[model samples]
Structures are given as structure tokens and as C-alpha cells.
Target chain A: MTGQSPIVYPGRMSRWEPQARERLVRAAVELFDEHGYDSTTVVQIAQRAGLTKSTFFRHFPDKREVLFAGQDVLCELLAGGIDAAPDEATPLSAVAAGLEAAAGNFTPELHAIGPALRAVVESNSDLREREALKHHSFADAMTLALRRRGIADPAAGLAAWLGVLAFTDAYACWIDPACDQELTALLRLKLRELRAAISSLD
Target chain B: MTGQSPIVYPGRMSRWEPQARERLVRAAVELFDEHGYDSTTVVQIAQRAGLTKSTFFRHFPDKREVLFAGQDVLCELLAGGIDAAPDEATPLSAVAAGLEAAAGNFTPELHAIGPALRAVVESNSDLREREALKHHSFADAMTLALRRRGIADPAAGLAAWLGVLAFTDAYACWIDPACDQELTALLRLKLRELRAAISSLD
Candidate 1:
């Protein structure tokens, strides 16, 4: 599905026009939130976004993709951050750097959407299963990144898993309506708490 | 579909018996291994077990349930281990104790079945997704157990996640034909490596 919109491209939009994609995602989330995920259709999402069905198809293969489109970008951000870490940095520190870089992308606007997104996912068993796989993929990416840094097995894998745990736990706290702390701060707190917990183990 | 065999029973077999359930599981796994998971049916499984479809239903609600029937027992064993840990143990130590207790249950016979079990799970995306949820459930159970011991937020959650990671990683290695170490030893090694990895982080 391809289409040429009548609107001319500006400097910002010329590189890669994301307006249509953004609109589709917003529309999909809103509709999924209002109606159930199974009840909502791609045609309805495209219509809600004021875009043609072709445009929606161009951005996402199906309705599920709207919620998960960021996974690849986030994975790259995490890996790139780890690759960019200082040579002397330990595996976990490099992982922390990657997590920090990823956290930078979760702006307040994204955090605001967390509850509704979580609700939608939690409502559907399929969505919940997909989300779990996505989380596992994140851990897998981190493990490979650590391996690239010359970290060995067990250590590399464990560090990656721990980093994921910190990120997931911090995000859970950061998304709470009552949480006043920034995500970066929460991430740091989580990492520290993890270290303390491990240290306390005999 | 019920039948009374000619064999005499002990006191335990005279009452609620698990021999039929065990037979069903063995038959199911054998059938799933021989035939593909999708192709295998309840009737076939029951017949292989020398029972009836009604008997299979009495044990497992469905074919998928046969694969996941161990989850509840494993969860309870983990929670019980945590609860039985010495009161003075740290959160992570308590978690380690729980993991060790669970590892004790993975006998040589069980380890021998791991490859086949893993094959069955890996062949189906739905099974893999359910396995991930089961893992998350284990972590949740451990977290609740840790909280019961008066451990705080991030520490309790992190410790629980780490415990799961250790158990999962250890089991993966332990299932390998090349692995010569015991499950308990591998688990300890994994936990130590995790501790070292986190300790090295600055």
C-alpha cells in the first residue's frame, strides 16, 4: 500500500515523514482503549487517523504493530549506547549506559500513555504474550551487546538480565501516577538497589 | 470412559491416585514427540496411556495444560522454600535458598526429559509465550515471598528477578549433554557469577 499525499514536505518532514505513522499509532491506541483490541479493525484506525488504509498498511502490517513499532528503535538505541560506552567501563556499567540512553527516549508524554497502553495489553492474552516476548528480545539484545564487549557467558547473560530487570522495574515505578521522580533517577535508584540486594546475599 | 483394572492397590492408590495422571503425561509427551504437537489429540494421548479421553480430561483440561501442569507445583515449591529460609537470611540469600530447593527437584530423569520438553516448547510460539508468562509468574511469586520477609520495593523485585534468571540459566546449562556439573552446582556458579558481575559495576 503506497500513497503520495498532497501536502508538500518541509525540511523536518523531508527526511522521513512520520506524521502518518504517528497518527495511526495514536488512533490505534485510542480506539483500542475505547473499544477492545479484538473489536477494533485496521480500517477503523486508518479512518480515525484521517489517513487512507494504504498509509496505515505502509507504516504497520496490522493493528498489533502500532503498539510494538518502537521495539526495534529501542533495541538499537540500547545497543548503540552500549557500543558507545567507554572502553574501560565494566559490562554492567555499559549496560547502564545503554539503559540510560533508552530511558532518555521515554519522555513524559510517553509515560502518560503507559497506563492506557498497559491496560490494553493486560486485557488481551495475546498482547500480554507478545509483550513478554518483546521484553525477552530486549534482554537478548543486551546480552549480545555485552558479548560484543568481550564479556563471557553467564556473566554477560546475567548482567543483561539484571539490566533488563532494572529497566522494567524502574519503568513500572516511573509510570505510576504518584511517581514524582524522573525516569533517569528511578533507573539509577533501581540499579543501586539491585547492587545492594546482591551484595547482601551471602 | 472410566475403567476398573484388575491390579490391586495400596492404601494411597485406593483413594485419589496420581498414577493415571503420570501415565497421561508420559503418553502425551511420547505422542507429542512422535507426532507434532498440533497433530496430537486428547483421544490419541488417552489411548496411548491405556486410558480414555474422559480420564485425560480428569487430569488435564487440555493438551496445553499437560505441558504447563508443573507450573503450579514449581511455584509452590519456590514459595515454600522462601518461607522456610532462616529468618535472618538476606533477601537475595533467601531467594538463593528458594532456588536451591527448587533445583533439588530437577532429578536426572527430569533433566533427561528437558531436551524433549524444550523441543516441544520451541516448536510452538504459543507454548514459548506461555513459558515466558510462567517465568514471570515465578518471579512474581518470589517477589511476594521476599516482601513477606520485610524486604523493600526494588530490592525485593530485583532479587526475585535475579533468582529466576539464575534458575533459568542454570537449567539451560544443566540440560546440555556437555554439562558435567550438577544442577545445584551450576545454580551456585550462576549466582556467584551474577554477584561478581554486579559487584564489578561502578
Candidate 2:
């Protein structure tokens, strides 16, 4: 699905010309949403964005990259959020702060982004594989955050990965009709449930 | 990359035709490993197995399905192993029994499989996706087993997934030249470490 509208931000946020970036993302999400990922093209997105092909290329390398325009920013926020947590915070606690930051970063304007993103991601095999790769990247980042607190073990990597899954699953549940909890509360609840499940194993 | 050669029963197993299954798996793995997945042909695999392409088709529906030749047997064995565990056993204990049964199912005859299977799966996106789907299927089977035991939350799905990952990560580590732990021991050690990691969070 095409992302948000092409808002022509004035001054400071004019890094790449917000209007063009916004148009590209918006057109991409719409195109992906309507026609599906494999069928969508950069040319069509550019056409829908009222821009030349060159302008679209200047804003995004390809159509798929347009949907993930803010991934780097999100990753930075997550990393910073985790690092800023208290030194004595548990791994999941640090990860919870990071996840909360991530949730907050997605403003109300981007509320529909989750399913739109998942639709495009699930339809393509390369994109799905990359989703797994991105998860691995996030887990690696979380592990580095834990290492800063002197938590050393191969288990650090596994725990970070499990933490991500718990948070992601909670987010999924939050968006589901069956779940009544808000995203933040749902994450805490899922983490508690996950902890209980794991603890009961021993 | 290929599974075990079929076990030749003295008389009782003769009706099962282990030799035919072994020939099919061996030929398929050899072709998939050497020529690569896309480049390899069912005709070639059949020729390598001294059979017709129709014979290969009889054994497998498609080229990718050959990679999962014994999945049904593995899933059955895994479910049965979990179900056979004592009612007093903890969830982790039950899951561990299933994992151990799976490991036992893939014997020394399949020792060279880890990297070869990984290579094929990694090289082909469809096969790579199939890996996750297969894991999900196994998780579902495990979840059903847990439900039969009156486990309250189907969050057992998450636990099943994490348990599988722990098994996979530990197995991967065991096969890595840098790791000194035996495969079986590493499985238990990883589970022990996982228990510690979760408890530490609480």
C-alpha cells in the first residue's frame, strides 16, 4: 500500500525534499496494496506520485525500499532507547523500552502501516526472507545493548531474539480483533506470559 | 542434505522397501547438492537413481518437496514422542523429549546433512521459506500435543517455536568447528542456559 501523503515539509525536514519522499512512499504503498507487490513497478509508482521516473529513483532506489524508508531511523531509535535504559534493567526491560519507543515512533498517521507492510512482505519470498534478516539484525543490535551491561553468554543472542519475537507477537495481537489491550500493555502482558511459560519449563 | 537411507528390516521391514526410498533420497540430495536446486532436474535425479522420471514423480510431487522427503515420518515421530512423555513432565521436558526424538531420527547416516541441507535451503528462496513453514507445522503439531495435555494457553505455540530455535541453534553450534560441545550435550546445555536466561529476567 502507498504510505502517507507527500507532505512538503518546510525547512529542516527538507533533507531529501519530504514531498518527493512522501509521494514515493505513498504511491508505493498504494500500488503494492492495490495491484500486489510483484505486479507493482517503480514507473507506476512514479506516475501515481506525479513525478518523473528520475524523481522517483532519486527518492528511492527501488519500489520495495520505498516501503522501508524509515527502517534505519527506527533501528537508531530502538538502539538508543535500549542503551538509555537503566544499567540494572533486565534484558526484556531494556527491549521493552526499545519496543515502546518504536511503537511511539509510528504516529497515529501510520496506524495502518502494519498490515499494509505485512501484506507486501508476505506476498514476496525475497521480502519475507529480508524480514527474517531484519529481525536478525535487530536481535544483534539488542545483544550489543545487553553486552554493554556486561551480560555475557551465547544465550544473550538467543534471549534477544526471543524477546523480539515476544514483542512482535504482542504487536500482532494488539492489532487483532481478539485482543482488547493497547500495544504497550499488550507487550508487557505478553512478556510476562512468555516469562511464565519459560520459567515453568524448569 | 538427504535424509537417512531406509532401514532394511530382516523380514518385517522388507515390505516397506527402504532401498527404494534410500535410492530416491540419495540421488535427490546428490543432485541438489552438486548441481544446485534450480539447475537440477527430476529426470537427472531419476537417472542417477537408476529409475525413470515418472518414478521420481511417484515419490515426490515437485522438486522442492524432495528436500522434505521424510517430513511426515519426522512429524509423526515428534508428536508421538511428545505425547508418550509422562503427564508429570514439565512443558519443557515434554518438548525436549520431542526434540531428542527428532535428533535421534536423524542419525549418523545423515551426519553430512546439516551444511548440505542448509546450503540448498539458503540458495533457494522457496526452500528457505519452506523451512519456516515446516517449523511452523511442527510447532502446530507440538501445540496440539500440549493442548491434549490440558495446557491452558496456546502460547505453547511461542514456546514450541522458541524450543525449536534452541534446538536448531545448538545443533548449528555443534556442527561448527569452533564449537567443542557434542551435539546431544549442546542441546541440553542450551536448554539449561535458556532456563537460566528466562529466570534471570524474573
Candidate 3:
């Protein structure tokens, strides 16, 4: 529901003021976990983050945007990686490069919040739909990037879709507390597994 | 927006009178093409079909339902195919079987309307979101069906997702007038191509 542009706040805040956004996210996740997404409000999230409601609004347009703000950054990383790949790179290779670039954003602290974020998303149908849309948006961005590299229709689309599938599988595995593997390592492993599975298909 | 249950129509019409539903769909598609989806009314669709407004309500709950009515049938076909697969069938094989079963539903007549349907869906963001949701629902149904056969978590989800990707790619090709292949054959070819693409990945 959040339609706010992802522009940085000028003048009053330094570019390094990442704490405000991060704090609001943390507070939203905690409150969403304690109560439900429907019952939580911006005032409560701001209060929990030791900030005012206006400050929360400056960062995110709505509570839903807090959970999804990372998607914009990830899409940019993916597109940038694809654009920076060698001119001779194949469609699948370009997609892999994009995914690898995006993987860098999922730091250990981000992984720590994965489970709670997933739980909050899974509990709400609207959130689930939004998540699916975000995933589609990522794939669409990848497809366009691949096409810019001179890839054809179905190949660009298929490679992009497969890349997203691998990313999703890797994220699920990396979020498990028992799995100590890093996100990049998990992504590679998932991609290999997907290749093997595809090879085994009748 | 359609929330109508799929219960059989009451004593007013025989089960064999599927023409009512088909006519309504044809009328709605025509109206949606001539006018935008947002401007088309259920009463107009019924009128164009030479049926009463109540008859339209009996088949679909709302205007949006007419466009997505096939999804339920496809999901059932997919699940049934997986359920009927041999016990020793691999997860991907089961997924292929499900896709093949669902492919039967895409008759030549339906393929003829593919471009129109795609145009209508692509023109509206709401319709695009609904289409993505339908795609997710199909994947979810396939995953559950695979799990019923004792397939593991990530594997089941991955196989189902790949199957849908193949289906999507194949459908795009099948709908092309220049491409004369049948839907089933196109699906098999697309699956083979996907496997080759994955194999070529580094």
C-alpha cells in the first residue's frame, strides 16, 4: 500500500543515518510478531523505535513498505550486475551474475531477521500477494536486463525465472538457524541442485 | 473479485448446458476487448449472451471471475495428474505429468484467444497482479500435491516452480500463429530446452 519514493531525507539527516530506517524495521517486525500486522500502527512502531511518527513516515509510507523496502535495492543490484557483466556473457550467465550481485545485500544481520519477516508475511494473504508481486517484479527486471544484453524472448524470461527460483530456495535454506552457510554459498548450492534436478527431469 | 463458489447451478438448467458459461465468457471477452475490463458490466455481458443477469451470477461471482475461471480447472487437473503418478516417479517427473494433464485443457480454440487474454491482462495492473497470484496459486497447489507423494520441502517447491515456468514459456510459443506446434509438444520441448539451459550454466 506504500507508494512513497525511496529518496533519502535531505538537510536534517546525514546520508549515514541508516539507523532510523533500520530501527523502524526492527520495531515493526517486533510489533508485527507480538500482535498481528493488522493490529499494529505507525505510532506504535515509531514509539518502539524511539522516534516520532513523522520520522517513520519519512522513511516508509506504510508498515507494508518496511518489509518490502529491500526489494528495490535488490532489484537495482541485480540490474546493475547484469549491465556490468562482460559483453560476451550468455543469458544464464548474465542472470547468475545479477543474482550473485543481489546476494551481497543479504548480510548476517538481515539473515537474522529473515524468519520473523517470513512469519509476518506468511500470516497475511495480502502480504503474501505483495511478496509474490515483488518476486515477479524482480524477475521482470532480470528479464529486461537480459534482453538488453541481446538475449531472445523465452531464454531471457526463462533464465530470469530460474534465477529467482534459485534465490528463493537459497534464502529459505540460509534463514534456517541450523544452516551456517552464507547466502552466496547457499545460492550457489541451490543453483547446482536446480541444475541437477532439471537434468534428471524426464 | 469473483467469490462465487463452484457449486452446480440449481434445477433451472441441466449440467450439460455448459453453453451458458461458455457464452458468458465469450461475451465478456468481447466486451473486455471492445471496452476496457473496468467499463464492462455483468448486465451487458448477460445481455450480449442472450441470458439474464441472474444466469451470469450463477456461473461467475463477478466480472473478474470470467477471466480467471480456467485456473481452478487447471489446478484440479495438475493435482489429479500428480496424485495419479506412479509411486516411483521422481518429483520433477510428477510435475511434468501434472503439467501435461493441464495442457489438455488448452484446446486450439483457447489458444486462439491467448493473445487477447494476454492483452487484457497486460493492460491493467490489477489484472497483472491477479495473474501473478494465479500463477503462485498453481505453484502452491503443485507443491502440496508433490508433498503428498513424500517429496522433500525445497525439492517439491522447486520442481513445481520449474514446471510452471515451462508451462508459461510453452504457452507463449503455442499461442503464436507462426508456431504450429501443439501445446503438449511445446511443453515437452520447453522442458527439454530448460534442462539444456540449466546444464549449460556454470
Q: What is the TM-score of each candidate against the true structure?
A: 0.84, 0.73, 0.77
What digit string (tens of lDDT, one per residue) describes model 2 on residues B1-202? Answer: 1465445456422344445556767787788899888898888887887876755665788778878776777677667877888999777777777777776666554555656767788787667657666665676677777777666553566556556666767778866656766666777777777766666663
TM-score of chain A of each: 0.89, 0.81, 0.90
Q: Which 10 residues in a row give candidate 2 chain B its minimum summed lDDT?
A: B11-20
Query: What is the alpha-carbon lDDT of model 2 when measured against the actual structure?
Result: 0.70
lDDT of 3 at A82: 89
* Docking quality band of candidate 2, CAPRI definitions: acceptable
Q: Please write out the lDDT profile of model 1 over residues B91-139, one tens digit for every residue.
A: 8788888898888777676777777788898999888878888888888
Single out the weakest 10-residue window by summed lDDT for candidate 1 chain B. B8-17
Model 2 vs. true fold: TM = 0.73
Clashes of 2: 7
**Against the true chain A, what TM-score does chain A of candidate 2 give?**
0.81
* Candidate 2 local lDDT, residue B75: 78
Pairs with steric clashes in candidate 1: none
> Which pairs of residues collide in model 2?
A1-A29, A1-A30, A1-A33, A2-A26, A2-A29, A2-A30, A3-A26
- A72 in model 2: Cα distance from truth in Å? 5.0
